[model samples]
Target chain A: MTVPISYYVVLSGLIFLIGLVGVLTRRNIIIILLSIELMLNATNINFVAFSAYLGNLSGQVFVFFALTVAAAEVAVGLAIIIALYRHTPSINVDDFRLLKW
Target chain B: MDSLIFFYFAGIILVTATLVVALRNPIYSALSLLVMFFHVAGLYVTLHAEFLAAIQIIVYAGAILVLYLFVVMLLNVKREERIHRQSLVAVLLGATLLTEAALLVFQSKGPVFPDATSSGSAGEVTGNTESIGQVLYSTYLFPFEVASLILLVAMVGAVILSKKGLLDQKS
Candidate 1:
């Protein structure tokens, strides 16, 4: 049996939801960053799937940009995580209370 | 033909992704995330995004996941830490969440993801490298350049912050 375009869309939504839950519930900073990447990848999957099914290349091009952005995000995110770890020796999200200032 | 492979890989991707987030050990979670990336790259194959697929594996699975794992190990976070909520209620809630996602995928109509644009007409489309390259270099060039600049700024800022952090601790 062949799958249609709708399947891809729904799968993208499912994966995205899973990623959202991770972002919402996880306390570890690294895990949260990973979840954010997962969310970004889910968006990329949607863009590419649409590009493929609609016979449009826009989504693929967007994926290219998204990939580059994700790389930058990880670099900066990891750097911040390292800094936090150094200060507190913990990477949990709840440990970041100094933000209220 | 493609749907079969897409479903297979998406299944693995979702499962591994769960393990990545749900697993108690940070290093194991990072490894499971690597598996998830591999499965996602497989999905890109089914989408005929060969270029994106290659980059996904090389950049994500190869470089990114390794770096994450290194950080995970480097942090030396304990395997049996009580930082994460380990209650039974949390476990049940997480399980139900996964089940809902599983049901959504199973009942959905087409491949794992679709654009859902509702384009009423049916005809040949422009889904290829040449066309994307044209649009990207032309219409999307401004945002593209801006993105690169933003990345450069972030890189420099990170280095500066880490250096400052070290300096501050020296006293």
Candidate 2:
């Protein structure tokens, strides 16, 4: 049987939901970040599949910007995480509730 | 043939991502996530998004995921199992996730996009290089340029944040 585009979409959706579950359930900040990466990759797969199935190139171009933005986001996010760790010597994200407003 | 390869990579991506989330060992999770990223890039290739597939490997698998690995190495998390022990809330949330997946599986019928396209070949259906280039250089030009500028700002912000206490410590 020839693989159809739906296969990719379903896989994307499944993986994305797993990542979402991780983000919502996991307390470890590093695991949460890894989950975020999984979510991003799921979206990337969807875009590529849709682009090819729809015979459109916009999806690939969008993927490019998404890649760039993800890179920048990770870099800045890790720096902040490091700073937070430095201040408290732990990466437990829930403990970052110093803002009680 | 094609179905086999696609499913193989799909299974790999899903399983690896699961390990990344389920493993208590943070460093192992990061490594598993890296493998997941490579599988994702393989999925992109099967879609005929050649350029995106390449970027998937270069940007995600190459750079961002590596950053994750590096941070994991640097953190040197305590080997104690006391870290983020699964709470009751987490268990409930995981049950909710399982239900959601079940719904999706039952509701979803396989292969939403039929292979029929303008080119009649699944591979050639979306060559999109020319049109994408046109839009990038025209209608979307300003946004594209603006995005680069924003990335520049973010890079600077990261560097500044990283260097904040170093100068004070030195002086």
Candidate 3:
């Protein structure tokens, strides 16, 4: 028998929680972005698992779109990082408090 | 056998995912993330999504990760000495969420989903890739085009954002 659906859900939830903690605790901007990727992948896992269990192609299609968005997000996010790094010597999140009141 | 393979992949995935977060060096973290991505693709394969597995490797591992590495090298970032000041709070929050999710999963009744093998539907007749293409090009045609548009916009934005003094010149 295939693995149970709940197992996948639990796995996804764990990954997502790890990502959340990373995003919250990490100082490096790149690592934060990587954490965001972790979160996205967790959701994608959930989508694919549901799709497979339900015997539907729509979930895979949704994943395809999610991948597309993720690619776009990475490109733009890195570009922003590059711009920010050029302006500041350090890549630490605390260094960019220009917006902070 | 199936559950064994699932556990194997799941174990590796969790470990590497933790490494991605716990590692101090950015390069080490990225490398661990790469490992996690591969195992995720393996998980997809086990779930009968061969096409997504391939796409996962090509897009996530091949493209996105290289971009991260490029920026990391370009920036030449030093290892961060301190985590966020509120890290303790973050850890507590994560622990709460994890406990809640675990309790929810364990409390659920067995086999809430339909059996894929018993259905014996169109997915079995045609290959995974073919069926996905059919649905993507037909039902998701508009969204497909929109995704391409998003890519185009992101490309342009990246180019503009990275260009020296581009925005400054305008202002």
Per TM-score, the best of the predicted structures is: 3
The iRMS of the candidates, in order, is 3.8, 3.5, 1.8
In order, what lDDT does every prediction score? 0.76, 0.75, 0.88
Q: Candidates sorted by DockQ, descending order?
A: 3, 2, 1
Better of 2 and 3 by DockQ: 3
The TM-scores of all predictions, comma-separated, are: 0.81, 0.84, 0.93
- Cα lDDT tens digits for candidate 3, B1-171: 999999999999999999999998899999999999999999999888999999999999999999999888888878575655777787688679778876986787878667666654754622289889999999999999999999999999999999996535543
- Tens-digit lDDT track of model 2 for B1-171: 888889899889889988987888888887888788777777766766666666677877788878887887887765433335566777788789789868987897655555644434434646455666775787678879978987898899788767657434533
Model 3's TM-score against the true structure: 0.93
Single out the weakest 10-residue window by summed lDDT for candidate 1 chain A: A1-10
**Chain A TM-score (model 3):** 0.97
lDDT of 3: 0.88
**TM-score quality measure for candidate 1:** 0.81
For candidate 3, write residues A1-101 as lDDT tens digits. Answer: 46878789889988998898788788899999999999999999999988887778888899999999999999999999888777777888988988788
Per-model tally of clashing residue pairs: 11, 0, 0
Question: How close to the true structure is residue B116 of candidate 1, measured as C-alpha lDDT?
Answer: 32
TM-score of chain B of 1: 0.70
Off by over 4 Å in 2: B79-115, B118-132, B166-171
Against the true structure, whose DockQ is highest? 3
- Top candidate when judged by lDDT against the true structure: 3
